[model samples]
Target: MGYLELALQKEKSLLCKRLGHKFKMASPIKTRKENRQVLYQCKICDQEAWLQWPEDSFNKLSENAEKSIA
Candidate 1:
């Protein structure tokens, strides 16, 4: 889990413990930069969506910890 992932998971776990599967957050994938956009694609959910970052990030992607999104 990256910083974004960690925060998202924490929110999900807390939601589940409190609400019992009433909500969910989709997983997001960020792609390489091109032109001026950085792609963000979700890989964990059925409804796939793409997002764009304002600028390219120099930091490499890494996994922090495992936590269920739903």
Candidate 2:
């Protein structure tokens, strides 16, 4: 990452620590379809992260929703 990107990341991290990350669902990647990957982008940082949909808990609310639905 460049200097500006690094600085932005640091600032976003601090903001996340204070208020938590505001994430949104990212578009699907056609190349990576091995395990039903789910991508999330942080609104504050504009960073991308991937997680396995069925295995990973995206957040506490998602976990709770799964439990209730199942």
Candidate 3:
């Protein structure tokens, strides 16, 4: 894979560790008029977020946890 793709995979792994669990899509993905929104949840932290397609929604939850801890 290219560097950018590799970096994104690494970031995703870090986010999983920070959140202390895996991510699950809250519902089946849907697309409408080229805009896509997906709901994601962290089982360990019970964090929920909605993010546009191709973005990392789990990172937001991990970032929030870091902020609260710091």
Candidate 4:
């Protein structure tokens, strides 16, 4: 079960990267509640395109307009 979960997570991560490229959304960063932020490196661009940390943190790319373009 643990292995399956890990694989699923990996797949999801890859899918997100793909979605970002498809939508021209670059700089995938994750921010902590404590205000510390970490940038995500894109596999598509191995270098020179790290997503800004804590950038647009509240925005979501989902189909829900309330979240996508809020």
Candidate 5:
């Protein structure tokens, strides 16, 4: 990468760390969907991450736990 690109990447990393990542759906042309998984790309850092759908039972369990704690 060129110096400007490296500097931009560094800035993005710092912004993501301080403000949290802003994620958006990746373009369909670039990724294929998989069962129970969603592809996301961070707008600030241009990094990719995955989100997996949890089973119904697991979701309910977590919700209940949070409610009880609160």
Candidate 6:
């Protein structure tokens, strides 16, 4: 898994083990920026967080379309 995914898993594991809670990630809040923002909320607790990509990323829609036509 990617670094960010691994970190999120580790955080979830820690929360499950320490506080006996579980969380679910919500859909991202769309924006024009490369760094998309998402929210995670606990299923059984009053916890919520906003997370963003660690680095900027180029748009992929055009790239995917080009590849499909090739």
Off by over 4 Å in 4: 1-34, 45-70
Write down the RMSD of all candidates, one decimal each: 11.3, 8.5, 13.7, 12.5, 11.2, 8.7
- Pick by lDDT: 1 or 3, better one: 3
lDDT of each: 0.30, 0.46, 0.46, 0.32, 0.46, 0.45
Q: Candidate 5 on 18-53: residue-level lDDT in tens?
A: 346555556541322344444566676676655454
lDDT of 3 at 43: 62
Return the lDDT, model 3, position 2: 21
TM match of model 1 to true structure: 0.25
Name model 1 segments beyond 4 Å from true.
Answer: 1-32, 35-45, 56-70
Candidate 4 lDDT by residue in tens digits, 1-70: 2211111243334223333431122343333434433334335544222233343543332223345445
lDDT of 6 by residue, 1-70 (tens): 1222313464443243345565555433223344454455566765655555444332353344357668
Q: What TM-score does structure 6 among the candidates reach?
A: 0.39
Cα error, candidate 3, residue 45 (Å): 0.8
Worst 10 residues of 6 by lDDT: 1-10
lDDT score at residue 6, model 2, on the 0-100 scale: 18
True-structure lDDT of candidate 5: 0.46
Runs of candidate 6 with Cα error greater than 4 angstroms are 1-7, 10-20, 27-35, 54-70
Model 3, 9-62: lDDT tens digits are: 444531244434655666443223244455566667766554454545444644
- The estimated TM-scores of all candidates read 0.25, 0.40, 0.38, 0.21, 0.38, 0.39
Candidate rank order under lDDT: 5, 3, 2, 6, 4, 1
Identify the runs in model 3 with alpha carbons over 4 angstroms from their true place. 1-20, 27-35, 54-70
* Cα lDDT of model 2 by residue, 1-70, tens digit: 2222211254333223333565455543211346555556666767655545544433443555457668
After superposition, which runs of candidate 5 have C-alpha atoms over 4 Å from their true positions? 1-19, 29-35, 54-70
